[model samples]
Target: MMSGLSRSCAVGLLAAATLLTATACGSGTADTSAAPGGGKPEVVAAFYPLQWLTEQVGGSDAQVTVLTAPGVEPHDLELGIPQVTEIKSAALTVYVKGVQPAVDDAVDPAKSFDAATAVTTIPAGEHAGEEHAAGEEEHAHEVSYDPHIWLDPSRLATVATKLGERLAAADPAHAQGYRDRAARTAAALGALDQEFAQGLSACRTKTLVTAHEAFGYLADRYRLKQVGITLDPETEPSPTRLSEVAKLARAEGVTTIFTESLVSPKVAEVLASQVGAKTAVLDPLESKPSGDYVSAMRDNLKTLQTALGCTA
Candidate 1:
């Protein structure tokens, strides 16, 4: 009954309105189980990376929420009332185990919820390397293999596969959708892996020094060296420690000193000054921006490449 252009415009408007309504209601209630008579399945992811992974596997069919926001230190965060409420209401809660011991203390594993996915064990030791200082209480948590398993492309695919299965089991009607999304996410992660391999293959200095020991997993997966980490992940190093690291940096010929956003770079800066090198900020998956998993990994790869002086 209307002109062609007018009809198209009307359809576009209707679609936009529908999308707006859905968005306003929030994507946190997209579970297939939550149909007319069924309730929505709410998902709570502990951190940004996991949240991104779950959302990719669940797509628009499940409502996914991330408790940790950008620039916040996941390991040191404590849950507030709002966050606890969100977790309590979620049908499924996904978290990278051991990365945040504080979280484990806050939530009861048996009583919090019936379905919880602790993706990787805390203090995951798989990639921590053998050089971890002896009798260091700090490394105690690093025993679980590497909580940062998401950094490994192959491992990330495994995670996506697992998440797909879990999501499908939780909501059978959208099982195929979850599977497809997982496959797509896996492919994207594979491409990211290739990019990192190619980009860092020819780095002049493979040794990395950082504010925290967080990069142990990344360095191990990429075959890079981690020279040392600051004593405290959050605090500034003492003058004695700073001088020691500076001497170590110069002795090792380290070109760049890396620090994360959530931690102070004072010690790293001192070390860099002593060694006449530069300082760069690296995100250790403590928090992530709004982009999807692949995009965030790509950004991290770029930062690492620049810091390491990789050719590609």
Candidate 2:
């Protein structure tokens, strides 16, 4: 997260470098040329999950570039000159609007697709609007609704359908290819959603206490309750909040306290100890996992089954 002055400074620097950095962003995967008429549309994805989905839907017909690199927290991303250029030049940019403030500022409305618009969004977590440390305040989750819609495979399937349409509209030459791939991707996501439904149909506990509130959509999809230690991954919960969650976890018989790779686990570990629960990793898909989206989500399903004592 960036402070007000730092964010303003970043915006000014980005504007200053717009004409200078004509090359593409270099930190992540190979940068695709953002030039016109390559027989493939150049697309920019804001982060990992969006990157994976864009690759799945775009297939070989479109050139996709991801802004956030592997293992980098999306919220903390500060746009470089090249990335700003990439977003401006790309035919389309796929992103969740509230996740990355930098990307939100850089993207063109007419060219970019905000994934949150594709689904019915839930309210932002209780702590979302609260004032935080200087840098954390007014960062991610400042919006009225949560933007982590990709957690629900069903919602992502909807996004796939819409993205395919968007891509087809952008590059009408490969319209059939885009639509076909989108349908296939949607079918695959539907299958994954079914697996989650059946796998978590009968869990021992419905309450989910996580390090952060990134899983709200997933909880909504599967009818589980998410009690997050904090709203933003960058925000630290107060001792009072921790104690409150610990007491609630004990009452709900929560056996696991979930954490993620990008965020520190100290708070989760302490809360787990206080509640006599074990700690487990629950990837929010904010960053690239060891495996791709489908495989990583399947891994999450297995983790949830074990943690929640699901029959499946």
Candidate 3:
């Protein structure tokens, strides 16, 4: 899939780079079209990750509708009335606050399971915000967090707990089921976190270069330094910036440049070739994944282990 970031890099490549909206990348592919049970209420997710969470926690008690289509970049998403209707009519709507500006405009903040409410985020402009000042200092080191919270399993587990409660409230008949599912999902996420800690514990290098900045949470969680080729999905970095990255890539001995399943690999390919490094697919879980959340994440774990040369 051609991700918004890759597209930006292709055309914009440091010249008047544009910023990609948070939804620019579609996430994991899960079976979201499952038939609802009798009285199984409707739950509308803003994107793939939310859809996956609701699907897992809600199980058979809810019918999840993900607004983002496969292969479609969610960034700069201009939603129509039909999609708005889906959100307005659903028994519950869950989304990240800053992920899709369109969703924020259409959905009521008080009623939705907003992930931004639960997780600390990087400064708005760090990734999705459009008002970031353009200058040489924009790339300076900072402690701001990115909004891709689900990349960190512990944060996602927190979201699952809160979303499960919301589901229970919406579907009283299956309240216990919702709670149980949340507990199980949290346990699984916890185990995944443990695996990552153990797996990445002995990596030869703690640096990761990705096509976009979606891995902030993941890198932070796993103690890896992330160098993104395109942090702003809509715009490409400046030539000066690219040159700096290329130089840093050489200095860091960064051997891999990762593209994603949802985004275009062209930018990574170009950059990898420039750096004399190999390209790999490091999914950020941005699309309607071909597999469920756990499987998708496990695949990511294996890829990370291999790419980072983890001992475990």
| Top TM-score prediction, candidate number | 2
116-173 in candidate 1: lDDT tens per residue? 2423323432223222333136546533454566666656777787778777777777
> lDDT of each prediction vs. the true structure?
0.68, 0.87, 0.74
Instruction: Residues 247-275, candidate 3: write the lDDT tens digits.
Output: 88889888888888767688778888999
| lDDT by residue for model 2 (1-312), tens | 899999999999998797445433322222334444354678999999999999999999898989999999998999999789778778889999888888889989998999899889999766522323422455634577888999999999999999999999988878899999999999999999999999999999988899888999999999999998887777777777887888889898999999999999999999998889999999999999999999999999999999999997
RMSD of 1: 10.4
lDDT of 1: 0.68
What TM-score goes with each of the models? 0.75, 0.86, 0.80
Evaluated with lDDT, which candidate comes out highest? 2
Using alpha carbons, what is the TM-score of model 3?
A: 0.80
Rank order by lDDT, top first? 2, 3, 1
The ten-residue window of minimal lDDT in model 2 covers: 23-32
Where model 3 places Cα greater than 4 Å from the true spot, the runs are 1-37, 122-145
